[model samples]
Target: MSYLSQITSPTLLIDEKICRANIKRMSDKAARHDMKLVPHWKTAQSHIIGDWAKEYGIKEVTASSIKMAEYLCGQGWDNIHIAFPFNTLEIPKLNELAKTQSLSVQVINPVTAQKLVDGLTEKVGFFIEIDAGYGRTGVHVSDFGLIEEILLTAKKSDKLYFKGFYLHAGHSYYMPDIPALYEQTRDALGMLKAKYQSEYPELVTRTGDTPGCAVMEDFGDIDEMGPGNFVFFDLMQANLGGCEKSEIAVALAVPVVDINRDRGEILVHGGGVHLAKDVLVDENGNKNFGEIVYLNEYGWTIPDHEDRSYLKSISQEHGIVKASKSLLNSVQIGDLLGVLPVHSCMTADCMGAYLSLDGKWIDHAEGCH
Candidate 1:
């Protein structure tokens, strides 16, 4: 039977060869840069996925939250970095985890730094979350007063040691000019490292943005890198010119429940609940939920430009695809179609499980398995 025969519903299909190749590419880049590769686990949140990372010399990994870290601990990952801003409210859980594991968290300010100083019971490390133009979290790179205070407070407790700055450079996701953003982020992190290296000699500069790390050639003064989504490059990354569509490792297999021949739209039993609401604006400036692909005995393939198809919109449990005439006439009510998600990280998080093209069921942290 074909691999599609194993997928009954909206399931994330991982092409192991493609996925492993993606991991090797990033890990090789990290090695070429002579920087530590702490691959982020937020994209493929499964122990089986992480085990594949091990073949590429990845010993330390990055998690988006403390709960993810806790989940990872059971999977044999002792050295984990909680890349999210440290929440003082989870001190008890953090302490419990730290008792037997080496943990680090992102500290955004002096108040939280001081709170961690007073609350943490076990030895842990921290990275000062620097905004670096992402405009989402962390103190701005030029905010020396806040930076100095956070470092000063963190010094009060021997339990917390500084691990230098962490930058996401998330703007690379939407910015038209990626090289310019990478240059700006490199300069920002370099300046911070220069300012603090005198006092904090052991502090290591780390960055975790997929676009910046994936396309940029020169990583100046970056000690370690942790990009999660590059392992499963999605359409968003391809649209940003970071990776080609062929490199994308994951695709959602959804069963077609209806087909509208007049509207050239195919309704699939997959939507926000299965693929998440992340969209990529297509060449025609329409909100595209995902790029459409036709499934085969091997896996799936994108159609030619003349017969291109994609998801126009999605609801909680339905995806409306703006299908090409060829695709519209080709698919039946019960056929399976593949969708390369706009954002693999969000889609992977939504699906919570992976059915490998090899017919193996993999377990996600919160998957149906």
Candidate 2:
């Protein structure tokens, strides 16, 4: 039987060829700009894929949580940076990992830096997370006093050493125009570098958003890139011009459960639980859960505009596909349909693992219940 027939329910299919290509493309871009490509492992979260990255000369990596850091460290990753804000509760775990690996964590305030200084028993690197208009985390770029306070606290500690600055321009994801997004990202990084470069010439400035890292040709004065989503580009990244449709490496393979000719919809056994609830709004203001495609020997083929279909809505276990009459008639019950996810990161997290086209099961960190 084909790989599609072997999958009984909602399954994530990873195309190894395309995935490796995406990794090389981003790695090359970082090299061209003379920046370190510390690709975030939170997207793939698999030791197998991590090895693939090492083949491209990637020595350092970034992760979102302490658990993920510990998992990757066990896989022999020596240089790991926990990109999330430093958690005081995980200080013991951080210290333990520091004894074995070159561990690093982000600190946003002086109090957090001081806590790490007091609690850490082993030496570890620290990055001052800067809020580059994302407002999600990190200290504001204009707040030099706060940044200095954190740096001072780290400087006073023998175990905690201030490394550099890190920022994620998440707003770039919403900007579909590549030029506009590139300018916004370049200006943000340039502004930060100009204000701090002279004082701390050795400190590195790191940027970690997929859209900027993928689409922008210039990285200004940023010294490192930490993009994670480029490992598996999704429909959302394609829509935002970060990548082409053919570059998407992973898709949800769902078995068709029902066909509705009257309503021109096809129901599948996959839903929000498998693909996550992330949605992309089109130019017509219609919400799309994902884009539809047909599986083939190599991978899958995205239909043309007129023949295109979309996942209109999804419940816990059911996904509604909106397509044309001819497209709806192309498949019957039990057929496996492919869905290009809106957000590959969230979708990969939901699935917790991947099944390659060659019939190998790739394991990852388990999803949260």
Candidate 3:
């Protein structure tokens, strides 16, 4: 039987056209800026997808963990950046990765820096993570003086190579509008880079965050863009004006489990196990699980439901839809419901594989324990 013909109920369908388009657009954006696009593979954890990126001229890749770094390295990917902080516990494994693969690790503190230098091996490269505007990991931008200290400290051993500086404007994702995020990211990186250039004229500036990299036009100070989410545009990205609805590549194909006409609700087999609890609410704080886009074979339309609405509620194994009376009355058991996830990363992480819209069962995602 063909892969699509074998797709059981409640499959994970990805639109191939949209996925390719997203990759092309981000690659084009990085090219226009004269910057290298090292997309975070943590978003789409499949080597198959990584191969797709490689075909688009993306040579370098980023991951969230040392394990992912090792896996990607073994799969013939040479340049790998572990975007997370340096964990002392994984020092041995990290050392091995560095020795075997072209590895770059992100470190934000003097303590980790000291540990790494003490355990110095010739394989690893380090990026001084400066907390530009994000309150997350990375040394404070105000601590520009420490960059030289970290470099000098690492230089104690010939084993370490301090490549440059890296930052993630994660705070940009919290902004209400993309323009506000763009201004905040631009100014923050600008000030941070100026301080760095004053101290270390030859240092490179690496910034990665989908919101900032996708919307900002000024790449004057940045040496490279490290956006991973741009490869798979989600509803959150859409809301942030990063991409259009046509650009969204992933979706959850849920099975209709129950219908309640009196209450105007439809239950689907897809729950937190498939769709996750990602939602966006209004000023009144009303939550939406996701949006119901289309139905299969049953004219079981969700009345008054459009791509802009939300999925409302989800239990461990069930998704609740808040629909109008007429639409709820038509839902039947076993009907296929096409739901757009609010966040593609969270949703894809829950699913173990992807069932293509063209009816191909593609093995995607890394089995993270």
lDDT, candidate 2, 92-192, per-residue tens: 88888888888999999998898998999999998888785677898987798998888788878899876788888887876556557556556766776
Summarize candidate 1's per-residue lDDT along 1-369 as a digit string, tens digits: 667778778989989999999999999999999999998898888899889989888888888888888878866675899998887889999999999889999998898998899998999999998987889999999999999999899889999999889999889887888888888888988999999999999988888889888889999878999898999999989988889998999999999999888888999999999888988775798998998888887878888878889989999999999999888777898999999999998898888889888788887877421
Runs of candidate 2 with Cα error greater than 4 angstroms are: 176-201
Off by over 4 Å in 1: 367-369
Which of 2 and 3 is ahead in lDDT? 2
Q: What is the TM-score of each predicted model, taking all chains together?
A: 0.96, 0.95, 0.89
Model 3: lDDT equals: 0.74
Poorest lDDT segment (10 consecutive residues) of candidate 2: 175-184
Question: Distance (Å) between predicted and true CA of 227, model 1?
Answer: 1.0
- Which candidate leads in lDDT? 1
Candidate 2 clash pair list: none
Candidate 2, residue 28: the lDDT equals 92
RMSD in angstroms, all models?
1.8, 1.9, 3.1
- Cα miss at 277, model 3 (Å)? 1.8
Clashing pairs in 1: none
**Candidate 3 lDDT, 17-121, residue by residue in tens:** 778788888889888988888888787877777877788898889888887777687666768888888787888887777776788888777677888888866
